[model samples]
Target: MKISIITVCYNSEATIEKTLKSVESQSYPNVEYIVVDGNSKDNTVQLIQQYNSIITKWVSEPDKGLYDAMNKGIEMATGDLVGILNSDDTFYDEMVLQQVANFHKQNNIQASVGNITQHNEEGKTVRKYSAANWNPEKLRIGFMPAHPALFIKRELFDKYGKYALDFKIGADYELITRFFLKEKISWKYSEITTTAMLIGGVSSSGYESYKLITKEIAKALNRNNISFSYTKIFLRGFWKLVSFLKKK
Candidate 1:
């Protein structure tokens, strides 16, 4: 299977090089890499230009936000399967894409998820996130797989839908919830760790961001007719707190 990796970047000059190098090192021969950059004032665009030989397609232009950039990348993708990796994140190893591609080819599933290891500013492991216990009912309680470790077939997006643009920080959660719960798509889980992401992502940077994320998550749940409760939001917050504390 041809896997298309979409990386959405904005002012990512500091870390995008590692992300691109990781993708370039993928052992999967038929992988197509596409990057959507949000016209950064920094050297992000120039940095991306360095990988022109490997990146199938890339665009640097003004966009709404990360989700908008991702939507654009999805529209540009032509591979059988699509995977999204953030600019600040990277695959665990060169074999990550190969494994994901082989899994999809062998299982014939619509989507699959693995694990993500989150690192701190010093690049030390902070927490390892996975969807080991995720189920349809668990999604109703605000649990979701690591977005960076998720890989889905292109047709799934064509059938179900893309990310909701209105959601700033919770679009990934909303889209995944819509897929597993509302659309009822089948998914496979692999215990293998796929990606390494940074802590303090957009949704977890501060208290205000947390509020926005929970607000958008509630909106997504209500839109999909899932049980919505403030406690669900609080539980997510509690987990974040525990993750940070454990890291310390």
Candidate 2:
């Protein structure tokens, strides 16, 4: 199956090269690479042009935000499967995509996700979300598969629709919840490392991080006909604390 790897970038010159190279080096041959740039004032567009031969399509234009750029990407994609690899992250290995394809064929799954490592610019591995034990229940309590770990069919986009633009940082999280939590989707978790994403993302370490997450979580729960309870939050918080201790 063809995999359309779309990357959304803006002022990402510093890291875009590595991201492109990672995709280009993939063992999977049936791949389409598309880049949606937010008219970056930096060298981001120029850097992309350097790989013009490999890049199936690329455009530099102004967009509303990250999710907006991503929607543009989803619109442009024409592959059997789709996966977004941001300008700042990369695959764990060249064979990652190839293996995902084979795994999907064997399991008859439309969506496949794996584990990921949150990292820094220097490539230091941060917290591994360790989504090996993922499920909707674990997700309701705040656990989620890393965005980069997902490889979904373009049909899923057409079926469930693109992300709602109301959210900023948590749009992807919300999209997954609405799709996976509300319906029976063909999905499987590959017990293997997939992506290494740069840590300290747009919302992770901000002063208003808690507030943003709180709003997103509340919205997600409300949409799914679920309710938030102090008990759930307390248990999840305690689970996080224990996760950290176990890591050490």
Considering every candidate listed, which one attains the maximal TM-score?
A: 2
For model 1 the local lDDT of residue 125 reads: 96
**lDDT over C-alpha atoms for residue 224 of model 2:** 72
What TM-score should be assigned to candidate 2? 0.94
- lDDT at 172, model 1: 92
**Error in Å for residue 248 of model 1:** 14
- Please, what is the whole-model Cα lDDT of each candidate in the order they appear? 0.86, 0.83
For candidate 1, write residues 1-248 as lDDT tens digits.
78899999888899999999998898889988999998898999998999998999999899988898898999999989899988999899889988887787779688898999999879999888877866766666667888888888888888888888988789998898889889888889977689999898887787788678778878888889988676867587687678669968
Q: In candidate 1, which residue pairs clash?
A: none
Best by lDDT: 1
Off by more than 4 A, model 2: 246-248
> Candidate 2 lDDT (Cα, whole model)?
0.83
TM-scores for all predictions: 0.93, 0.94
Which stretches of candidate 1 lie above 4 Å from their native place?
239-248
